[model samples]
Target: MRLSRYFLPVTKETPADAQIVSHKLMLRAGLVRQTAAGIYAWLPLGLKVLTRIEQIVREEQDRAGAIELLMPTIQSADLWRQSGRYDAYGPEMLRILDRHQREMLYGPTNEEMITLLFKDGARSYRDLPRTLYHIQWKFRDEVRPRFGVMRGREFLMKDAYSFDLDEEGLKQSYEAMFVAYLRTFARMGLQAVPVRAPTGPIGGNLSHEFHILADTGESALFYDAAIDEVTREELLSADASTITRLTDLYAMEEEEHAKVETCPVPAERLRTRRGIEVGHIFAFGTKYSASMGLSVQTKEGGQVHPHMGSYGIGVSRLMGAIIEASHDENGIIWPESVAPFQVGLINMRADDAGCAEAADRLYERLREAGIETLYDDRDERGGAKFATMDVIGLPWQLIVGPKGLEKGVVELKNRATGEREELSVESALARLVG
Candidate 1:
């Protein structure tokens, strides 16, 4: 993509309303714009990053044996009523009325809708074990929505529902999702720690929240130091035992940690840090199935309520979480897997025909090599181009200037490490492409 043709509206001044690092950086980087309080219109760059994160979540869900299907943003309030949660779910749910005076709502979560859908379709024990997922927008009426997308009222989410015939089957499905969540966050260059959490309104005896470590995170975490030893490589291939090993170690949120009279972990081994919640998993068993009259005939000719579990990953909030965990003083340091573009091709001397020509040819070569590159061919000063590239935080910046071209080399700068190396045009292409 060419910067001159792009719609990035970057600004040097930070928005006074943005209190958090992610929110401030997001605005300065031109990733999103606030249309209303807590509601944002994702600009092109923000959409690209969001799409990349969504795809990663989708792939990991698929690998865990979950099937994908999209659900609507608006749902009949009758569904929530059937599940006995209409009155229980508070003001967060945006209840509405249609022209016909029928009750409806913008769904905050899909437990009720998914339960009704599954109830209508599955009739026999043979359909007992199924995991269905969808990536869609969800709305919640937050009283004080702030911190950009981190606590946005409208956001994208990946929610999956799992139905099983028995408690044992439900456990298997829950564990599968738990491992998949670990792999998903790791792929995006995050180390997510799973800690036991209250079921809250979702209503489940078993629940876990996945949080990424960050200094500016909202949740304070107390965990064993060993949890940090689990590497990304191990998480990508982690299994059920991985859950056993990690959960066995002590970990808790600030509220939960305060309840304990005596700490189990050694003082030296206990680590305290802040974390941002990105995903949550719950095994609610018959909570919805029993309340909603969802049942299937057993092979032995008996009626039984299917056990259910819901898994959620905040698809949009992850952008803010990633930025909170990864950014530096300059701007966001995007992980390669979720970066909008892998490389920023800067024409340091756009007025120079040689520099522009070199940048254009290199951009074409990058595209041909399947490397996502953003070429800055705008008629701007070298310093401005460099600043723009740094603010957007592409993983790499390829500097094409007349002096470097004359030297038969282009400068390649690593965004994360701030390391720059001069390489021949061929060498730079090989390095980036590889």
Candidate 2:
């Protein structure tokens, strides 16, 4: 996309309200704007990154056999009442009333709604094991919403509900989601460690919170060093015995940690790091199902409540968490999978005829090759242009100036490595496209 045509309203001055680096950069880059205290309107550039992240999450969910279906942002309060959570959910639940004075609410989670839906249609045991997921906006009235999207009151989340006929079936469903979460974060260039977490309001005895370590993170986590090397494919392909072996690896949140004489790793490798909770999985057996009368007939002709599990990923919060985990002094070093654009083309002399010609040709070449290229063809000074491009931190950058154009050579720079090479336009194109 051409910079002149794009709506990226980048600014040099950082906003005083932004306390964190990700929040500050997001504002400076014109990625998002505050619509309310904790609500934001995602700008074009921000939306592009969000969409990319969502696609990766969707793909991973689909791979795990979870079907996607959207639920409503607003839900009937009667559903929560049926689940006996209307009064228990506390202030985080945004209770509301319609014009006719009927009780309503903006759903913070879909346990109650999903349970009612499952109970209504799924009567027999034929649909015993089914997983339904949705990527949608959620609202929670945070008393103090801070750190941009990291703790926003209104944000996007991908929540999935799994229904199984029995306890054993529920375990299998949980395992599938656990493996899917690992692959989803890995594909986004994040190493998320699964740690046992508090159930909180989403009451469940079995729960795991996937955390990405960052200094600015909110939660303190402890885990064995070996978890870093474990891959999703390894876990997914493992047998029941292997699954037990892998799951036995020591990992827990600070709340669950109890000092022991024997630890899994040596003292040096016993790492305790502050991390942001990116995703969470829960197995709440018969919690909502029993309360909402979500029961199915057994083969023996007895009514039984289906076991349920809910998995959630903080979709919008991940944008901030990723920036916190993967940025330098320059700006965001976006992972290629979630980058707004794959490459940034800098024409040092946008007004100059020769430089413009070379940049235009390179831009077309990259676009035709299926590369997402952002051409910085604005008439700015070379230093300013370089600084801007570096701040945005595209993986690859092509610099075409008057001198380089005259010599039929352009400079190519890899943003991550800070490596630069002078090559002919054809050579650069081949190197990038190939």
Candidate 3:
């Protein structure tokens, strides 16, 4: 992608309405724009990052044995009524009426819709265990939505529903998702800690929220420091017992922490930190199935309500969370996995025919090598171009200037480390492509 042809509307001045670091940075970097209060239109650059994050979530869900299917943004209010939550959901539900005077709503969640779908489609015990997921937009009428996408009223979410015949089966599904969440966040260069959290609104007896530690996070966590030691290898090999091993260590949100009669961890081992909640999983036995008449036949010729669990990852909010966890004073330092473009090819002297030609050739080479590179071919000053590259936070910046090109080399700079070294054109290609 060439910057001259791109639609990035970057700015040097921060908006007064933007309060948080992620919100301010997102605006200044031209990643998103506010169309309405608590709502944003994801610009091209922002959409690329969001798509990358969504794909990671999808891949991990598939690896965990969950099937994918898309659901609609608008749902019949009758579905919520069937689950006994139409009114109970409160003002955030965004109730509406169609021309026929029938009730409708922009779904905040899909528990009711998914439960009914499974009940209508699957009849026998043969379909006893199934986990279905979808990535779509959902809206909630928040009274005050701030922090950019972090608390947006309209956002993208990956919510999965698991149906099982028995309590034991639900536990297995929950643990599988638990492990998948760990792997998903780790792949995006985040260390998310699972902490026991209240079900609230979703209504489940057992629930856990995965949070990424950051000073600007909304949730305060009190946990055993050892919880942070769980590694990617362990998560990959994890089973049902993985839940026991991690949750057994003391970890709780502030509300849960305050209710503890006695602290489990010794003084030194207890760690308190602020974390942004990115994912949540719930095992609510028979909550939706029983109410919505979703039951499977038993071998004994009996009908029993299927146990259900819901897992959610804030697909859009994650962008803000990542920025919160991984940005510096310069701008967002995107992880390679979720970066919009892996390399920012800056033509420091675009007006110089030699520099422009070399930069264009390098961009083509990077693209041919299956690398995603953004070529800044705009007629701009070197300092301004460098600042823009840093603001967008591509993993690497390939600098092409007459002086460097004349020396038979180009400068390669690491965005995160600010390490710059002159390398032969071929060497630069090999390093980035590798």
Candidate 4:
């Protein structure tokens, strides 16, 4: 994508309304624009990052044997009434009325709706163990929505529903989702720790919230420092024997902490830090299924309520949370996995014939190699172009100038590491394309 032809409306001055680092950087980088108090219109760059994150989440869910399906943004209120949550859900539910005066809602979650769907078609235990997921937008009317997308009124969410025949079967479904969440965050270059959390309105005795530690995070979390070094491969890449071994690690929220005298590590090894909740999993046995009449016939020819679980990942909130965890003082240093573009080609002398020729050739070479390259073909000052490229935070930057064009050399700089090297045009192209 050529920068001159792109719609990247970057700003040098920080907007006064943005209070947090991610919020401010998002605006300055031209990733998003506020259309309302908490609602935002994701610009081209922001949509690219959001799509990448969604793909990662989808792949991980597929690997865990979860089937994908899309659900609608609007739902009938009759389903919520069947589950006895019509009035219990409170004002955040965003209740509405159609022209016919029928009650409807922009679903905040899909527990009741999914339950009704399951009850209608699934009749026998043969379809007992099924995991269904959808990536869709959700609306929750927060009275005071703030923190950019982190606490927005409307956002994208990846919610999965699992069904099982019995308590033992439910455990397997829960474990699968637990492993899936770990793999999802790991693929995004984030270390998310699973901590026991209150079910809240979701209503489940067993729940876990995956949090990524950041200074600007909303929740204060406590965990063993050993969790920081534990990888998803360490937990999920082993046999059933190893599952017990990895699950023994001490990790929980402050509410679940015990005051036992014996400690696994030492008091010093315990780390309490602020973190943002990225994903949550809950196993609510017979809660919605029973109320909604979602029953399946067992081997004994008896009808029983199917145990269920719901898993959620705040898809849009992750965009902000990732920026919070990854950005530097200058701008966002995007991980290669979620970067909008792999390289930024800055034509230091866009008006100069030699510099333009060199940059154009490099840009074509990078694109032909299947790299996402953004060529700055604008006739802007060298310093301004470089600063904008840095603030945009492309993984690599290639500079073409008149002096370098004469020597058949270009400057390559790594965004993560502040290392700059002058190399032949061929070498620079190889570094970027290879």
Candidate 5:
């Protein structure tokens, strides 16, 4: 993308209402714009990051054998009524009345709708186990939504539903998502710890919340450092035994941990930190199925309700969470896997035809080499371009200046490390492409 043509409306002044670093930085970087009290319009840059995060979540879900299917944003209120939750869900569910006076709602979750689908589609035991997922926009009308996308009223999410014939099958399905969530967060360069959590409105005895530790996070957490040692690949290949290892660890959110009278782990191993909630998994066996009368004929010729589970990863919220977890004073330091663009190509002398020609050639070569590069070809001052590139925080930056062009050298910068080196243009391209 060329800065001259791009729609990045960056600002020098920070908004007074942006309380957190991520919220302020997002505005300054031109990632998002506040359209309402708790809603935002994702600009081009923000959309790119959101798209990349959603794709990573999809790949991890697919790897765990969960099938993808999109659901509607507006749901029939009758669906909630069928599950006996219409009145119980409260104001968070944006209930509405259609033109014909039919009760409707912008869905906050899809547990009831998914149950109805499973009930109608799987009438026999042959379709015993299945995991279905969807990535869509969800709305929860918070009375006081704050902190930008971190607590937005309208946001994107990946929600998956698992159906199983028996308790054992449900456990297996939950385990698959449990591990998949770990890998998903880790791939985006986050260290998330899974802590036992209350089922809340979902109504399940088994639930876990994945929290990524950050100083400015909302959730106060108590956990062991061992949770950080596991790798993404290890979790990707995890199994039943992996569950045993994970469950044995002592970890909980501050609210739950504070209620405990005694601690199991040694005092030396205890650590307390604040973290952002990025993902959640629940195994609510028969919660929706039994309430909705979703049943299938057993092999023994008996009708039985299928066990159920639901997994969710906050897709849009992750953009804010990642920024919270990884950034410096300059701006966002995006992880390579989730970065919108891998390289930022700057034309230090955009007005100089010779420098512009060199930059143009380099941008083409970088794009041709399969690198996602953002070219700053605007006729602006060097400092302005540098500031924009720094704020966007692409992993690597190549600066083409008139002075360096005379020496047949361009400067390559490491955004994360703030290291710069003048090297031959050929050398810079080789280092990035190869």
Candidate 6:
């Protein structure tokens, strides 16, 4: 993508309303614009990052044996009523009246709806276990929504529902998702720790919220330092017992840990940090199924409610979380795994015909080699180009200038480390693609 042709409306001044680092950076970087209170219109650059994060979540979900599907943003209130939560859900539920005077809502979550759908189709124990997921927008009427997309009223989410014949089966399915969550966050350059939490509205006996530690995070968290050592590969291939051992690491969000007067992990091994909640999972047995009459035929020819679980990842919030967890004074230092563009090409002397031509050729080569590249072809000063590229934060910066062309080379800079090296055009291209 060429900067001159792009719609990025980057600003030199930070907005006073943005309180957090992510929110401020997002605005300054031109990633999004606030359309209403707690609601945002994701600009092109922001959408690309959000899409990348969603795809990673989807890939990890698929690897864990979850099938994908789509669910509507608006749902009939009758479905929530069946599960006995229509009134209990509170004002956060965006209640509305349909054309026929029927109660409808912009769904805050889809537990009741998913239960009703599965009940109508699958009837036997043969359909013993199934995990279905969808990536869609959900609305919650937060009285005070702030912090940009981190706490937006309308946001994209990846919610998965699991069904099993018994409690034991439900646990196994839940563990699969647990492992998948670890892999998913790691792939996006985050070390999100799973912390036990109270199942507030979802109403489950067992629940965990995955949190990424950041000084500006909303949730205060306590955990064993060892939890940080677990890798994506280890979690991805772990058995149920191996995944279960994660709970033994002694981690809890503020609400859960506040109940315990004494800490379990000892002073030395214990670690405390402010964390952003990015994902959550719950295994709520028979809550919705029993209420909605979503039962399957057992082997003994009796109808029984299946044990179930729900897993959720804040797809839109992750972009903010990533920025919070991975930024410097200049701007966001995006990880290559989820960066909007892998490389940024800056025409440092765009007014110079020679520099512009060389930069254009390099951009073509990078694109032809299938590298995700952004070309800054704008006729701007070198310092302005440099600052803009730094704010957007691509993994690498390819600098083209009249001086560099005379030296028979281009300058390459690493975004994260601020390291620079000059090399031949061929060497730079190889470094970029290879």
Give the top-scoring candidate (lDDT): 1
In angstroms, how far off is 210's CA in candidate 2? Answer: 0.3
Task: Count the clashes in each prediction.
Answer: 0, 0, 0, 0, 0, 0
TM-score of each: 0.99, 0.95, 0.98, 0.95, 0.97, 0.98
Write model 4 residue lDDT over 157-250, tens digit each, in one string.
9999999998898889988888888778877778787777789999979888889889999877667787776765764453444334435666
- List residue ranges in candidate 5 displaced over 4 A: 231-238
**lDDT ranking of the models:** 1, 3, 6, 5, 2, 4
lDDT of 6: 0.91
Error of 6 at 352 (Å): 0.8
Residue 369 error, candidate 1, Å: 1.2
TM-score of candidate 4 relative to the true fold: 0.95
Q: Please, what are the lDDT tens digits per residue for candidate 5 over residues 49-132? A: 999999999999999999998889999988899888999999889998999999999999999988887777998889989999
Give one digit per residue, the lDDT tens place, for model 3 in 1-434.
Answer: 99999999988887999988999999999999999988999999999999999999999999999999988888998889888999899999898899999999999999999998898898878987999999999999999999999998999999999999899999989988998998899888888888888898899899999999999999899999898788867765667677788889988889889999999899999999999999999999999999998888988889999999999999999999999998888899999999999999999887888788888888888989999999999998888898898888899999988998778999999999999999999999999988
Pairs clashing in candidate 4? none
Against the correct fold, how does model 6 do in TM-score?
A: 0.98
lDDT of 4: 0.86
Error of 3 at 332 (Å): 0.3
Candidates 3 and 4, the one with greater TM-score: 3
Model 1 lDDT per residue over 1-434, tens place:
99999999999898999999999999999999999989999999999999999999999999999999989998998888888889999999999999999999999999988988999999999997999999999999999999999999999999999999999999999999999999999999999999999999999899999999999999999999999999889899899889999889899999999999999999999999999999999999999999999999999999999999999999999999999999888999999999999999999988888888988999999999999999999999988888888888899999999999999999999999999999998999999988
Clashing pairs in model 3, backbone N/Cα/C closer than 3 A: none
